[model samples]
Target: MTPITSFFRNLEAKCCAACGQMIHEQAESYATECAPCQEQASFDAYKYYHQKR
Candidate 1:
């Protein structure tokens, strides 16, 4: 198998996989989603339906 180091580029910044937003160098190490996406991460379509029960 190829080494893990050869799999991905050592990037300073990259776009979010889900939302295509810029993740800066400081947050790239841990951030999978940007602030806007992260803030709304709990959004569920069934939430409103469940609440009515």
Candidate 2:
């Protein structure tokens, strides 16, 4: 497989994008970050976009 396809295929194995945690949930296998990281990222993004200049 090409490098790009290999990278995406690895996504099916559950590697957290932020913390590098090994996730075991089938639902999160395709997700970039595990639950906590995803939550924190979402919260951070919300704050970043809404915060005062």
Candidate 3:
């Protein structure tokens, strides 16, 4: 693909829900949050659930 085509494609790319970081299609198939954000969300959920005990 041409550089300009790649640039425009990224302009409409999906971004991480938490940090608003761009998520490339090549990196993931259909990810909502980036890897780091997903990990943090998992950790937060675990901590919250454990704290209720």
Candidate 4:
């Protein structure tokens, strides 16, 4: 797949846009942080719940 397609595919897999953490699909759209990462990334909160640990 193309690089762009591969990136979005990662989103479908609930991967963090910033840290590549695996998380819930529900947190895919408009998100980049999992629960743990979100907590620490309060400065730049990732909409997603699958943030890095």
In terms of TM-score, which candidate is strongest? 3
Candidate 4's C-alpha lDDT?
A: 0.66
Q: Please give, for residues 1-53, the per-residue lDDT of candidate 1 as tens digits.
A: 86656544554567787799787656327778777776676565457668889
What is the C-alpha local distance difference test score of each model? 0.67, 0.76, 0.80, 0.66
Which tens-of-lDDT digit does each residue in 1-53 have in candidate 2? 56975665576456787999987686434577888998999999999989955
Residue pairs in steric clash, candidate 4? 31-47, 31-48, 32-48, 33-51, 34-49, 34-50, 34-51
Best by lDDT: 3
Clashing pairs in 2: none
**Which regions of candidate 2 deviate over 4 angstroms?**
1-13
Please give, for residues 1-53, the per-residue lDDT of candidate 4 as tens digits.
Answer: 56976666665467766688787856336676677777777645654444675
- How many clashing pairs per prediction, in order? 0, 0, 0, 7
Shift of residue 37 alpha carbon in model 2, Å? 0.4
Q: Local error of candidate 3 at 29, Å?
A: 2.4
**How many backbone clashes are present in model 3?**
0
Give the lowest summed-lDDT range of ten residues in model 2: 5-14
RMSD of 2: 6.0
Clash number for model 4?
7
Candidate 1 has its poorest 10 consecutive residues by lDDT at 4-13
